[model samples]
Target: MNCTPIVRQHPDGQSINYYGVTLFDEQSSKSLKGIFTSWRNLFESAPNTFEITGNFVDWDNEQDGEYERININRDEVVNQLGKIISMSEHLAKGNCYLYHLGK
Candidate 1:
């Protein structure tokens, strides 16, 4: 399968609008999980997640005396997203269920 850009961002001076560009895989189910994976990978994470390279705190949202959530790096997340978008045929066929654990 050929790879394509799954996201785009429109810059406006100091802010950007993130958008997803996706192509449905004929053999896979178009569930929310599938689409959300791509979205999270493309923009919902910081560029430097593990402090390995580049700016680490640029996009991360730290709690102001609220809850503590660790920062996530985008590169690793994107790699996983690639796996999701290009999911194996065998995986798609597994009888799996999606459930909400908490309200």
Candidate 2:
């Protein structure tokens, strides 16, 4: 498969280079870097398909703010949260560790 190079400006006005080497945006070239890695979470499947959520919570260690919060299980959430952070830093936005691809 052959792919043409695609360039677009990010929301921050920074230019991002994507050199397609496989098919469309499926693969990139040595000269360019893509928004997110194609491979991420391919084991645990979730509803949103992304491990991260939009729900914002200011984790202020200080007691001045909200004392505590509630969500999914603590241990489970902590584990999933770690994966989410690592994945988000790699992917652009839409995609996340919430969904799995394959084994």
Candidate 3:
């Protein structure tokens, strides 16, 4: 499994910037889904600053993997609760941009 953290701007400037995770396999996708589900409440509490989306996308010419996008405000992440806070910290330590989180 591999996880890469990335930042993406909203097209047409319609929404806030997004933090994304590109997972290389089904196992990584499932694991991340569990973590995200466990923190769903924390995410829901801040609708504007936190959001999650998952989809399958081509990883290369012959493979596909899960792409998870989390819309976040860096400042607001510091105020979140529980494991969500820790996860945010981990991501931020990678500078909130393109960085590898797992392999």
TM-score of each: 0.34, 0.21, 0.23
Model 3 off-target regions past 4 Å?
Answer: 1-23, 47-103
Worst 10 residues of 2 by lDDT: 30-39
User: Which candidate has the top score in TM-score?
Assistant: 1
As a TM-score, model 2 comes out at 0.21
Residue pairs in clash, model 3: none
**Could you give candidate 2's per-residue lDDT for residues 10-67 as a string of tens digits?**
2332233333112212122321222222222332233333333443445655444442
Give residue 28's lDDT in candidate 2 (0 to 100): 26
What TM-score number comes out for model 3? Answer: 0.23
Summarize candidate 1's per-residue lDDT along 1-103 as a digit string, tens digits. Answer: 2222222332222211233233323333344345656575555565566433333343345533333355666776777766654553333565542222221
The root-mean-square deviation over C-alpha atoms between each candidate and the true structure, in angstroms, is: 12.0, 13.1, 15.2
Q: Could you tally the backbone clashes for each prediction? A: 1, 3, 0
Taken over the whole model, the C-alpha lDDT of each candidate is 0.43, 0.33, 0.43
